[model samples]
Target: MKKLSMIAAMLSLLVSTGSQAMGPFEVYEQALRNDPVFLGALKERDAGQENRAIGRAGLLPRISYNYNQGRNDSKATYLNERGNLHEDRHYTSSGSTLMLQQPLIDYEAYANYRKGVAQALFADETFRGKSQELLVRVLTYYTQALFAQDQIEIAQASKKAYEEQFQQNEQLFRQGEGTRTDILEAESRFELATAEEIEARNEQDAALRELGALIGVPSVAVSELAPLAQAFQSFPLEPANFDTWHALALANNPILASQRQALEVARYEVERNRAGHLPKLNAYASVRKSESDSGNTYNQRYDTNTIGLEVNVPLFAGGGVSASVRQASANLEQAEYELDGKTRETLIELRRQFSACLSGVSKLRAYQKALNSAEALVVSTKQSILGGERVNLDALNAEQQLYSTRRDLAQARYDYLMAWTKLHYYAGTLRETDLARVDEAFVRR
Candidate 1:
């Protein structure tokens, strides 16, 4: 009973320890929330929002207060028989006023605000694009780490088989049933397997370290990834016509969206420049107060109030306004051309990703069949050897073939998963929810 209890305790400890290890999707989630690049993109989006606010402010009313106080030494003048006389005197004057200006009809302000709105939308899309890009990178590294782990397992298994063969050959040589050449061959194979195992282990370790750094947890240990399973079964493979994909790419791609916004901004810039040739009108009002000690006046204090309208007509500006309008128009044209180019490029990429996804799925199916055949062959060879058939190099060759097939199958599965992810991402359908599903698949239960 005590032995059983100890075994149970050990099993429980292993489970507890293994639960601490994170999987690929969990790592991606943690990186999304903590990674520096994502955080920087978020900050940039916020800055763009602030810029929108600043632009909007241009169309709003502005109010200001002004105050002035001064003391002056002067002479009083009287319109009399002697014309004017100077007298030693000093006077203090003070005034305060309030002014308000509203953009009653500013075309430039309207265009600028419109541009700001477009820019803000573009920034939001850019942030989303950054998030998608980060997720792709995380998936790539995670799959690479899994591939390395599989390679290590394969190498270790091969090494163990070679070691067993070596021991068997040693026993046969002792009995004078096997030649020294067989023993030496087994030893050489065993040494090669050991070297391969070491190389595989080192590669896995490096991959782990790289993933850890990417996820902002440099100490994390990635134990294992979930077997690629039914998650990829429902991936759509219908080859979308070029026109259909082109339309989707134009509408959904972040780069295309950003270019479209840039074009809008450039168009608005032209409008803003053109508005510079229009007249600007404003209204102003002020009140003033003064005090004198040596003037023939009814009171020592006086006040004045005035109100008026002002107009500024842009008659000429050394052709600067025309040059600005021309430059803005040129930029607008360039932006339009860029938008077209980006749309075409994105459509091409979508087609390429779609093709890759289809090919990967096909490859996965073929590899799955190959893996079954390899396993069968390994079992058959083992049975033949056990049935008194002399185990020759054919047995070793069959084992090696089985190992290669299994590794290739694993690689095919990962490739299919990656290709599926790429398809969804390009389709703009890879969302946080999809990531959450991936997380659920990898979670230790």
Candidate 2:
């Protein structure tokens, strides 16, 4: 009863504290702005959006201009009716040519444009997947820190209880009312609890460091979890059956969607390479102007404009086109295999999380019952010690059991919450709204 009152008082103090605490969703928001991995994905998506423009360029008209200006000196020898005539000329010559070409028929360019569309889609889906991953990662760190904090609390409580027992046992022994074995046992347990408290504090520091790295901070204090009764209220909205989750994953998983786009890209690559066997056709126009030529025509100026159609039929390219086609086909095969493997792996992961969530609920209930039983045992053992039916060592062990049960209950709570989040992540349904829902389970400060 006294421990319960103490816990209630601590909760009240936390609720009334003025200092702010970071919630998981807030951490996620910070990570969105600061996480290098997610920022890189955003850049990659922006880069992918240019693929359409790059591929379409092959189908567009192209224009080029060339100009040259130089002084030329030449001497020419001519033999006509006379024996020989020598001519010398020096002139400044300048010329410019402008040309334009438009593709009349280009199967490879068409395939490339389609491939670009697929690539852009792939990038979008990849970014979406990264976004979900960041949310999952932030929450994971938050839960780890929470669990570590719980461990520290449990260790401290156990240490304090053992210290009190040791002092009482030492005084009793000094007064010839307690055995030396009881005093030694109490002292030993107290030292072990102190060591455990130190280790728990270290684990908490490491967990906080990990969370800080994600959000680009040196350290952070996370908000306490909402009361268990309140946190559990969110679970009823989860899907009931495994089939529903599996279907959702198949339909919506961003990774799988990205891989499908990759497969389309590989298919178009094969088409682009295969089109190399086909003839190419282009329409071209050119304007040319020249001021001077060699010695004979040194004083002449001319301008010309022309339009024409060009055709190139591939006879052979030393088997380069065929090799490229073969390579693209091999790549397409690899993409197919990868998508198949990823689908299976995704389903497997989904199943694992689904199972964990279900089992976690049951485990939470079991641990809660165990905690109640352990608390009762502690009270009973202490009462028995007063009546001389139980020794001091039994009371110490009961206290340890109660603290251990508290730790287990705390861990189960975190595990249940994390498993629920993970299940949604694997289903590709995690979103900021999901984070909002998770935020309901945490105090703001």
lDDT (CA) per prediction: 0.71, 0.83
Compute each candidate's TM-score over C-alphas.
0.77, 0.88
State the number of backbone clashes in model 2. 0
Model 1: colliding residue pairs: none
* lDDT tens per residue, model 1, 322-419: 99999999999999999888777777777777777767777878877887888898788878877858474556667778788878877876776676
For each of the candidates, give the backbone clash count: 0, 0
Q: In candidate 2, which residue ranges exceed 4 Å CA deviation? A: 1-19, 175-184, 222-234, 293-297
Report the lDDT of model 1 for residue 284: 59
Among these predictions, the greatest TM-score belongs to 2
- List candidate 1 segments past 4 Å from native: 1-25, 71-89, 162-215, 224-246, 283-309, 378-397, 440-445
For model 2, residues 1-445, the per-residue Cα lDDT tens digits are 7466445544533553346565777677767766778889999999998898888889999999999988997887889987888877778988899999999998998999899999999989999999999998888878787777778778888878888998999899999999999988988887887888788778778777776666555565544333233235236636789999999999999999999999999999999999999999999999999888545457788899999999989999999999999999999999999999999999999998899888887787888789889999999999998998999989988998998888888887878778788888889999899888877787653
For candidate 1, the lDDT comes to 0.71
By lDDT, the best candidate is 2
